[model samples]
Target: MKIVVKIGGKNIDFKNEDYFRVLAQLVKEGIRLALVHGGGPQITKFLEKEGRESQFVEGLRVTPPQDMEITEMVLSGLLNKMLVGIFHRQGIPACGISGRDGFLLEGEKYYPASGDRKVDLGRVGEVKKVNPRLVHVLWEGGFLPVISPIAADREGESLNVNADWAAARLAVALQADKLFLFSDVPGVLRDVEDRDSLIEVLSWAEIEILKEEGKIRGGMIPKIEMAEEALRGGVKEVFIGEGKEMENLPLFLAGGKMRGTKVVL
Candidate 1:
């Protein structure tokens, strides 16, 4: 089965042994998998090292022109290649490429609605289109494609696309069987403070009700929105789980009860 796995950079310490073990297992499973990863934390660290100020409004980072350059440098240039190396070390043939490599992802600038005012986040973008030809070609050639969320426009200008949205779009384009979103958190929690209160399965309608009741807020809001979009766009299933427990990926694919939340249409 074809799967799209998105790994977040927040808790990703590349030296972590468990991370590599889980990644190796996924590749060894012989299931076609495409990895989409975000390196926001790394980018932020780079910016700080350069003595640059970083700002965020409504959880979206405002990428200034210089910051955009650093984002591309860190995400596509550094993190992308690192992941490919990891997979290769596990005996998995992997190819790391950015959205700009083949225009794999096309997008337009995003103006987020922050309360009554609109926030212009510079080169920040939302995925407007995904060309799956490159992905298909790589998969057919027995290579796992690892994508960075940095996209380029028609004018050859690069933009910072949200990794979650990019993965959702790619899942739709590939008509993937499952999309696994690995975040720092375990899953959607019934109460933010309770780790044992993870919501295991949620339907679209139930998600809406949760949002209406103001239970799903903050960073989770966009994640749920993206998952719903993937479901509506043709992905059969979407899983939101903790990256730390990535060993459960195969079990989840096998229809076993996973340690994270499963969102269905």
Candidate 2:
């Protein structure tokens, strides 16, 4: 089965051994997997080292020109290669690439407005188009495509794209059988402070209710929204679960069910 897996940047520091083992197993199973990753924490570290302060507007990083340069350096250069190295060490033939490579992803700039304040987040972009042919070619050639969230425009201007949105677009483009999003948390919890209150399955209607009741708030809301969008765009299924508990991935794929959340049509 073809799958698109999105790894969150926050989990990078955790060094989840299970995650790597699961990935190796997937490769051994001959599953066509495309990895999409975020490196916000790494970017933040770089910014901190450079004595640059980062501003966020509505939870989206407002990247200026210099910040964008650093972002490209970290996401494409540092984190992307790190993942590739991990896969290679596991004897999996993997190719690390940026959205700018072959113009796989192209997007327009986004300007978010908050009341009277209009923020100009330089280089921030939303995924507008995806060319999955590049990924398909790699997958057909027996190579996994590891993607970093950095797309370019028609004029070759690099833009910072949201990793979740990029993964959803790629999943739709590839007609992937499933989209897996790995997060630090277990899954969508009914109560923010209650770890045992994981929502195992959610239909569109159920998700709407959660949103209306404000049960789904903060970063999780966007993750769920992205998964919902992917489901609506024709991807067969989408799973959101813990990156640290990578052993559960195969179980989740095998219809064995997981403790995490599943968004289905």
lDDT measured at residue 4 in model 1 versus the true structure, 0 to 100: 94
Q: Model-by-model lDDT, in order?
A: 0.85, 0.85
Mind sharing the TM-score for model 1? 0.93
lDDT of 2 by residue, 1-265 (tens): 9999998888775365546878888888999899999877789899999999877665567888888989999999999998888888888888999999887999889877768886689989988889888898898899989999999988999999878888989898888999988887888888889888888888888889988998987567668888988988899888888777667778877877666788876
- List, residue by residue over 144-185, the lDDT tens digit for candidate 1: 899999877778799898888889999999999889889888
Indicate the worst ten consecutive residues by lDDT in candidate 2.
Answer: 12-21
Off by over 4 Å in 2: 13-16, 113-118
> How many clashes does each candidate structure show, in the order listed?
0, 0
